[model samples]
Target: MAHPLDYLYFSAVMYTSLGIGDIVPTGHMRFIAGVEALNGLLLIAWSASFLFAMMNRLWDWEPCVEPKDEE
Candidate 1:
């Protein structure tokens, strides 16, 4: 049937954090979109967190090194 297609279509919309206002769902289906939106937000946050951690691990990123005064 078209159920999976519809789910995926809406999910794709959700993935991009886009609500085109075309596929409006009724009743319980409405909750699905909300969940998708939340998922998208969490995923975006998670990606940002992961990238920050990766960068910290990869770079020396040192600041305020002690100055060496040669006598």
Candidate 2:
């Protein structure tokens, strides 16, 4: 709290959902950590869905047709 680097360190840990246990959050700060973890999860899920949709759209599979033999 005294130095700017402390805030950066806390934010990096919270956003990544690492919860390294080196620094503990108290009171309302705990709520913020929970929210950050949830947001990170949602963001990851959204990214996976977006990538799946993009890949599906870009890749297409067609059934192969065989020619009939002459009698």
Residue 48 of candidate 1: its Cα lDDT? 97
Candidate of highest TM-score: 2
Task: Give the count of colliding residue pairs in each prediction.
Answer: 0, 0
lDDT of 2 by residue, 2-55 (tens): 588887888788787888978788899899889998898788789999999998
On a 0 to 1 TM-score scale, where does candidate 1 land against the true structure? 0.66
Runs with alpha carbons beyond 4 Å of true place in candidate 1:
1-6, 61-71
Per-model lDDT: 0.84, 0.84
